[model samples]
Target: MSAFSRFTPLVSVLPSTVPFVGPEAIERQRGLKVEARIGANENGFGPAPSVLAAMREQAGDIWKYNDPENFDLREALAAHLGVTAANIAIGGGIDELLGQIVRMVIEPKMPVVTSLGGYPTFNFHVAGFGGRLVTVPYVNDREDLSGLLDAVKRESAPLVYFANPDNPMGSWWDADRIVAFARALPETCLLVLDEAYSETGPAGSLPPIEALIGLPNVVRTRTFSKAYGLAGARVGYAISTPGTALAFDKIRNHFGMNRLATAAALAALKDQAYLAEVVGNIHAARERIASIARANQLSPLPSATNFVAIDAGRDGTHARSIVDGLMQHGVFIRMPGVAPLNRCVRVSVGPERDMARFEEALPEVLRLLD
Candidate 1:
């Protein structure tokens, strides 16, 4: 195939491949359907009825572009979060915002720090911006905050990514410890404290808004995709000092937000009752997944997120086989990508129907493996 040859050296050097192989792609490649659909860490309980109604009502307004400044959504998010409007930077999702942050600070070959098996999307963004990744391995299935800080200092890294109630492992440190870790880092390093699973975490697991509110170096990325059930809507934001928040405006897509998605987000925020209801459902589903893991004679790692990581009593190969076998029964799920952590498969909480599919299929998968 012939192609244009005017691309930058960095762009030409990089592989034009996506990091995630979504279930849709899996189904196409393997000729299998994803019946359970409990993968991707998405809230399978679905969005609120009120949100659906709002989207339906606003469907006619799709002809208009969303406010370039995102005025209404910003005001509502600020009001809900008890922060000034100037402190927030809205984006398509945490993923896009991660790219913007990387673009802001990372020049070619600059070092960025994160857990070895942390969120791959952030690392993808870092690589896109020509940043060198310096990873600290997980300590007992959790991102090591102290180790991350050490790497930042030792490498004089300018950017670090930390996910609360982290992905893949679904582990978290308490608010105080997280705050201490943030404070210990040098002011030169900016911490992207990702709280994509904050709503699913236990009380006190997340730091208060006031804890790191004043730190210019700390930008916390949050998503409505978790407990809010709005992953398809692609609503996410970051909170930081006004100056730091304004940095996003320089490079972010000014009119990229979808019209109906904004209406859905506004409606979702107005319905705290519904959010509380979904959060309860999430907790129950988490317990159900853990119970299923236990009944299969596997160890279910405690998690503050909407997913549970089960120890398969073996290695990554065993974990991978269990994951593949589950998919044979239309149970789509995922596991970590590295050793030690990859010894476990991750399952997201979903409605009873999905849970039932997993519960029925898990034993058969394990029995086959055994």
Candidate 2:
């Protein structure tokens, strides 16, 4: 009737939680089918035909263990990014890679810097490793670069997590500013530049890969989950100096790469034309979301990511009402977990029908809330 008593002290004290409450869990809890799945930032447009075909081809290989080194995928990613394979480290996705990064760098009580209300999963990893989280609040709905720098310097932190085309709020900074922020950090602190939304960001938003690839302290994490429409594939990679990347080999799950998922990613990378088409669709959906928000008299923040965060013209409580109200109508959406940011509802881009469902639900939700 009781749990094992021999677990580590850190594990014993950690609260059991998932950083994001997914739509499936909501469906189970509320007994409502999600008719419009515009939450969790998933690309509802789905993956390319080439990607699905590649996965189907690899289906028979499920009986075999994936290549432990993930060589072909690494090589493919390296070639795609114009970096050598040595500079890349593949993991299930950015989420897994984040845990590996925290494990590699954070020790008990070590300080980890991040923007407050930034990526909560990274903070969850930091907590699991017993690292102290040093947070800087967002300034004007964007990550505070200068404040984050100050926190790192003040705490002499070993790691900092920043996202470009950031989540929840979907704001981004120009590449020059990010490069400058990365360069300004002390060599002792490692920067986790999360670029999960990189493919969807506007021009001038992402730095050239070369800008920080040479920095041993800089590791850029990206995923196939966003614009590539491969969230379920769980394929992601980290780019850093060859020396910096080898650290992952020390603690990562060597055979964690799924064979079919790797096949999907490889095919996705090869089909650049499909990626371009998806990005265009994402742009159009963002505009549609903005228009819907405007119609409801809510202010939509300019987004460079696949989602739009609309200011609901009230506080977190009101925003929660909107989120809950939409779910009641079988339309799922999300909002930020922290103050100020929570005043906005975050909606992911999807296909026309999904957008139409959201467009129809917004006014009704707002009307009920009003």
Best by lDDT: 2
- 141-240 in candidate 1: lDDT tens per residue? 9999989999999999999999998998988999999999999999999999999999989888999998998999999999888888999999999999
Candidate 2 lDDT score relative to the true structure: 0.95
Q: Per-residue lDDT tens digits of candidate 2, residues 1-370?
A: 6999999999999999999998999999999999999988999999999989888888998999999999999999999999999999999999999999999999999999999899989999999999999999999999999999999999999999999989878999999999999999999999999999999998999999999999999999999999999998899999999999999999899988889999899999999999999999999999999999998899999999999999998899999999999999899999999988999999999999999999898899888887
In model 1, state the lDDT of residue 250: 91
Each prediction's Cα lDDT score? 0.93, 0.95
Q: Candidate 1: worst 10 consecutive residues by lDDT?
A: 11-20
lDDT score, residue 352, model 1?
Answer: 98
RMSD of each: 0.8, 0.7
Q: What shift in Å separates residue 331 of candidate 1 from its native position after superposition? A: 0.4
lDDT of 2 at 339: 89
Candidate 1 TM-score, true structure as reference: 0.99
